[model samples]
Every structure is written in C-alpha cells, then in structure tokens.
Target: MEALGQAITSWVLEGHIVEVPGLGNIRAEVRAKAKSDASDVSADDIFRHHLLLTPTKEIKNALNSTPINITCFDKDGNEVNRD
Candidate 1:
C-alpha cells in the first residue's frame, strides 16, 4: 500500500495523471490568477495547487445508485423527522 501511494504521488508531482483501477484518474492541478501582460505572470500568481480527480463511469454509477437516509432530531433529543 505504501509503495502504491508513493508511486501515485510521484507521478502526480511529475505532471502525469495516475489512473486507479475501479476509481478514477488523479492529477496535479494549479489555480492561478490571470495577468494581462504575459511578462507579469509568475509563480507567485499561483494561489493554490491541488489534486484533481476524474472519476470513472463505474464509480459514478455506483455512487448514483446508492441510497441515503436522513433523520432529524429535536433539541430535546426527540425524533422530529425521518427521510
């Protein structure tokens, strides 16, 4: 498990997308502010760097098919509503 995690991290850090079986493709992403002048742009313009995941169809389908149950309680711990 550790080795697999290391490999994923390494690939993403190297600007490559790593695909996980039955899950999705993960890649590194950055959000930067746009500058009118190309020369004005720099690494400082990048405010955030994160991972982006594009889930597979199978994973999306499984999530969509799953059911969610919600229950609400009153301040006194009495059941108010159930869904």
Candidate 2:
C-alpha cells in the first residue's frame, strides 16, 4: 500500500504517469472528482470524491488479467459456497 501511495504521489507531482516496466504505471488523477450533492432524505449523498483512474490501454487490458482462487469458511471452518 505504501508503494502505491508513493507511486500515486509521484504521479500527482509529475503530472504524468511513469511505467515501472513489470508492475505497470503509477497514475494519479481525481479518481472520483470531488463534488457536492444532497439527497432528499439526507441519508446517503456521495457528491464529493476523487477523479477516476483512466489507465493506459495496456494497463486496462491487464486488469483482472490474473486469476485467483478464493475460499471462505464459516465459524466451524465449514466451506461456504456462493451457490
């Protein structure tokens, strides 16, 4: 996480992204741009945020490029299947 933070900081400071070869590029953007909006009920209003990431074509293609195996268990250690 620290590495990601540093990379993002650099990106923000540099105003451009730098590809780290194997890892990918360090990108910094609003992510979800901050804004202001209110809900009628005043329950959940997400108007402020950061800009979204617009990864390079290559980077975007790599997203979810790797497959992983996930497993979860209950209190008794019994496997829990999504199905």
Candidate 3:
C-alpha cells in the first residue's frame, strides 16, 4: 500500500495523470495566486497545488447505485462508528 501511494504521489508531482483501473484518473493542477493590492507576495509563495480526480463512469454508477459503508478511523486506528 505504501509503495502504491508513493507511486501515485510521484506521478502527480511529475505532472502526470494516473489512471486507476476502475476508479479514475488523478492529476495535479497548479493554481495561480490572485492579484492583491495590499499584499505583495512572490508567485512561488502564493502558488498552490491541487489534486483533481476524474472518476470513471463505472465508479460513478456504482457510487450512485450502491450503498457504500465508509469506515472511519481515528488517529489511534480505532474505528469510529457513524451509525
């Protein structure tokens, strides 16, 4: 799992789109900073990175049709019940 995560991160950092089998394509987008009159900040400092996920049709259909049970976990790895 760690290796897979690393691979995905590397791909996104390199400006490449990663396509998962049945899920979607993950890509990284750089958002430019807005111009402000009061603050003068460098473009590098204000630039932000964002991850965009485009889900596949199959995954979208599944999400719409299926009742997904999302398991929530805490920092200590304890399962948090939502019900």
Candidate 4:
C-alpha cells in the first residue's frame, strides 16, 4: 500500500499520467484561479496544482451496481469492515 501510494503521488507531482490496474488514469493539472479576461495575473493568483482521477467505465459500473466493502485497521490494531 505504501509503495502504491508513493508511486501515485510521485507520478502525479511530476505531471505524468498513471494508470492503475482495474482503475483508470490519474493525472495532475493546473488551472487559473480567476476567469477574468484581464491580463493582470500573477503566480499567486493561479491554482498551481490539482490531482485528477478518471475512473474506468468498468469501475464506474461496478461502483454503481455492486456493494462495496471497505476494510481498515482500528486504533487498537483490530480489523474493521465497512459497507
């Protein structure tokens, strides 16, 4: 899990597209904060970074049609499952 998380973070930060198996692509993008036509814009006035996730059609369909299960470890190191 740690390795996968690190890979996703590194790829996204480098503005590279990453395709996760059974999922879609993950990418980074930058956008202007303001939608004005004025030419008075500075670095601080822009939204520098954003992570975008485009999930695959199969994932989307499964998400809509099937029950999802989420498992996590509790503070006491006990496994918990959520639906």
Candidate 5:
C-alpha cells in the first residue's frame, strides 16, 4: 500500500496522470490567476494546488448500484429514524 501511494505521488508530481486499476485516474492540478501581461505571470500567480480523481466506469456503476442503509438514534438510545 505504501509503495502504491508513493508511486502515485511521484507520477502526479511529474505532471503525469496515474491510473489505479478498478478505481480511477489521479492527477495533480493547479489554479492560477490570469495576468494582464504575460510577463507579469509567475509562480506566485498560482493560488491553489489540488488532486483530481476521475473514477472508472466500473467504480461509478458499482457505487450507483449499491444500496445504502441508514439508521438514526436519539440520545436516549431510542431509534429515531431509518432509511
């Protein structure tokens, strides 16, 4: 697990999309401000960095087909609701 995580991190850092079988593709992204002049743009213009994950069709289908059950309880330990 640790090795897999390291590989994913390394690939993303290298500007490559890393695909996990049966899961999704993960990539690093950055959000930057637009500058009026090209020369005015710099690394400082970048304000946000994030990771994006695009789930595989199989994963999405499985999530969509799965049923979720929920049960709520009161502080008194009594059942309040169920879904």
Candidate 6:
C-alpha cells in the first residue's frame, strides 16, 4: 500500500490526478466542495486522494480456500444427484 499512498501524494502535490497502471484512480478535491465565491478559505482545506484496485480472480479464488461445487435442488428441497 505504500506505493498507492505515494502515488496519491504525488498526484495531489502536482495538482493533478494520477491513474496507476493496472490500478484504480487517485485524485484530490476540496473538502465538501466549497463554493468559489465563498471567502475565509483555509490553506489546509484540501481533500485527500484515494486509490482503488480491483482484484483478479486469482486473488479471489485463492482467498476462498473452499472449492466451489455446483448443486441443484428438487421440488421437495432435496439435493438432486448430478449424474
């Protein structure tokens, strides 16, 4: 996750968003979408960027140790035989 954090920081500092290769989007925005015409804005008013990553089936299947087995149920609620 260090890489993700670093990428977000760099993007925010550079005043632009960065989409990591094979990863999620990271962008910065003002907190609560303050109005442009409003006054008394603080310098610390900045929204932190976030990073998201979608995992592949390899990771998901590995996490689920239990192998999947297809099954069917009959009208009486009994599991029908595959054969």
The per-model lDDT (C-alpha) reads 0.95, 0.60, 0.85, 0.85, 0.95, 0.63
Displacement of residue 21 (Cα, Å) in model 1 is 1.6
Residue-wise lDDT of candidate 2 within 38-73, one digit each (tens)?
334342434443434556677666776856678888
Give the best candidate by TM-score: 1
Question: Which candidate model has the greater TM-score, 2 or 6?
Answer: 2
Q: Point out where model 6 deviates above 4 Å.
A: 1-4, 33-83
Write down the TM-score for model 6.
0.33
Q: Model 1: runs farther than 4 Å from truth?
A: 74-78
TM-score winner between candidates 4 and 5: 5
Residue 64 lDDT in candidate 4: 98
Q: 1-83, model 3: which lDDT tens digit per residue?
A: 89989999998998899998888999998777666764765667556778999999988888799876778889999998753
Which of candidates 1 and 3 is the stronger one according to lDDT? 1
Is candidate 4 or 5 superior in lDDT? 5
- In lDDT terms, how accurate is model 5? 0.95
Cand. 1 Cα-lDDT: 0.95
* Weakest lDDT window of 10 consecutive positions for candidate 1: 14-23
lDDT of 4 by residue, 1-83 (tens): 99999989988887789999888999987787774666777777776777788999998898899876788889998988654
Q: List the lowest-lDDT window of 10 residues for candidate 2.
A: 38-47
Ranking by TM-score, best first?
1, 5, 4, 3, 2, 6
* Clash statistics: count for each candidate: 0, 12, 0, 0, 0, 0
Once fitted onto the true fold, the runs of candidate 2 whose alpha carbons sit more than 4 angstroms away are 1-11, 32-67
